[model samples]
Target: MSLSIGLVVHASRRGVFEEAVEPVSGVSLKWVTYGHERDIRPHVQSLVDGHALDGLLVGAVPYRACRDVLPRTLPVAVTRNSALDLALALGQAQARGWQAVPVSIDTFDHEVVCEVTESLHLDRTRVTCLPYADDQSVDEICAFHRRSLHDGDGYVITARTAVLRQSRGDLRVLNGSPTPSSIRSELRELLLRIRSERAGAAGFAAGVFCVSRHGCPGDPERSRMDLLHLLRATPELTDAWIENRGRRGVVVLGRRTLFERLSRDWLVAPVLDRAQESLNVPVSAGFGVGSSARTSVVLAERAAVRAESENRPCGYLMEDSGLVLGPIGPGGLGGPGGPGGRSAGQWTGPPTARPHREQGDRMRELARTVGLSPATLSRLAAIEHDVAGRAVTPSELADAMAVTDPSGRRLVRKLHAHGLVTSEGWAQTHRKGRPTGLYRLAIVAALTGSADGHALETV
Candidate 1:
């Protein structure tokens, strides 16, 4: 008289996933990938082919795979821990700094919704709401709306595949296997393009990180490759001499799918490929989907979870790497990889390689839980990453998150109150002959927790 759930599956597909469920138990692993589309596609294809499931647990084996897989939705969850993940980006865009659209479900108060829209600077005319038949329909409904919205302008889509498949490969090659040679090529092309566009802009321009820049941290050649790729694509994106608002603005030309997966997957599979035969280490990544900082965060949480769970010290697989295998699935990784780990799966979510990380390597170690639309924790992460990063002081963070900003003292207070950010002192600079207080990153490592900030700790 009770139902069960099966968190993972081998090649045998005819088992009752519900049979594996234990009531009042831990979360179920839905879709886990071993970095190869071949290792994962069939199980996950059902998700995109209109098959219905109670929940979706998406994992990316690599950037290219995620790019191929997430052409639209799968908005992405930044963390597996439910409490810590805040679904910051279901539809807000300004917070993430990318263009986006929100899918309204007819539940929000019209005024509150409008305020959110205006604050995000989203087009008032482009907003929409629909009815959801159980949570399963959320994916279907969002997919439809995305099609209706037309697939041209910048958008924050859900579904890991949306993020994975959405990017056109020009974005991939630059960061593809990031080597010095690749960087040079990407830079050459990117410069030509930039010069053709905004030929005379003096200040720094926004740069975007497509698949190449998604998780290039551990691979310098790859990072250089990605940087040059982005530079080739958007040449005006130079490291500027003058800082904007006392901060540097770098647009990592990231793809929505990679962004979505990176949000959750970075922590799982930090390494996507090898560079000169050496393994990449615990690299960091970010995910941004939809149109808001919240959604971007939602994507980040999802990527982080996948990254943490799947990544290992030596080049490894989600199944073979001695990782504390959660219920997520993907079969064993097909094999070890060469430079950049190219595969349909890597293009979708291929297996990855990593070097090392001490026990304290991770910046965030959110508990592994469930729920894509993280309720609270995701919000806090967004605050620290998106809003708080903008603040000169604590009060600015509060104001940025669109919460209570009474005295503009919320940055340090909120972070300290919640345990996310720490502050130094104000410094003076000569811009307009006026001195100013400048704050630097004290301890703003991304952590998971509640609005109250008790759970967050330096990972």
Candidate 2:
């Protein structure tokens, strides 16, 4: 099936995206254009409500304006101005007899500006860059340019069209917008991610839903039947093949996609709440995906055993790839930490049992030194362990910690302040915007007393 992708762009930049996407097989584009950032939310919301989108493509402005409305499951790519775009803009400025030095640039990262200026042999100290922030208003950006120009900045460069309009033709402004190639690259990548997810969703899946045996007043068989009836009545499971498993369990066979929807991408499962309420007993569920039905069933049984061991109404998912996610019941999609807490669904390898007394004391000491809770320090240590000394961006850290992007950035900054992490470099994970800053976590080293001799690093 051809994937349906929604393209959200400013009216001025609509042609750029349209021209770049051109025509591609197995993909259909739906354009949603807006004249201003404020108009983006309504248009994007309408697009999402009116059509079933396989993915979405948007620039940073549109993305920032409507990010809250974007469906969590839908794949989205946010295009931003790249270093190449800035270099091109600088080339244009030079052609127009403008000096590259003593220039004010907006929306690009400080590192990118320095890299471009240093490479071109321009004085880096003469360049003023205001990095993009989601909460920054266009007025604030325009004010920055105005102040720079007033203070002897020779020219102004910006990625935002609104900033240009507000310039009122008085400022020597150069548009450093993303080129067509950048948009096309992001579009193609988003398509690839969507297709990959769809293909993986078709894999075989088996689920075991067990009624807890402790603290229940009814016959085990009756409770099992009640659980079975609940599964049978679930509208989302209508297509699945469900049957009795063991003495107090029900087994369900279905596609991975069906289970993903029920569990909200393994974040939480609301059906467990319904089962517990209906059967008047704790209900635990385990879902597994594998190469074959038997393999999936065995994994599901093992996951169910883990969930049952919790002795509460909770759920877990086990994939043949050795990823485990769990404690997903009645938590309102917050996973283990419940909204802003450490995300329980994040797979940081096999669950680490609680640390021994000596290890716990060391962790507590490190936490005290860093002014963070021991529990938070332990989670960071686990993430560090999983990455095995590899660098990660704030977005990746946020995903692993199950927090918002802004929160992840803040956590990184805090860790950087306390010497628990060191800036490695910048990475262009996406085709647009500024390259994300990457950092290597030293929490493990700090906890194990290995960072005593090294000087704290900075980006």
Kindly give the number of clashing pairs for every candidate.
Answer: 115, 1
How much does candidate 2 score in TM-score?
0.57
TM-score of 1: 0.20
- Model 2 regions more than 4 Å off: 68-73, 118-121, 151-153, 207-254, 257-286, 290-315, 320-323, 328-459
- Taking the tens digit of each residue's C-alpha lDDT, what string does model 1 give over 177-267? 1122322332233233333222212211111222223343555554445433433342222332211110111233233333223223323
Candidates' lDDT values, in order?
0.31, 0.74
lDDT at position 359, candidate 1: 14
For model 2, the local distance difference test gives 0.74
Model 1, residue 253: distance off in Å is 33
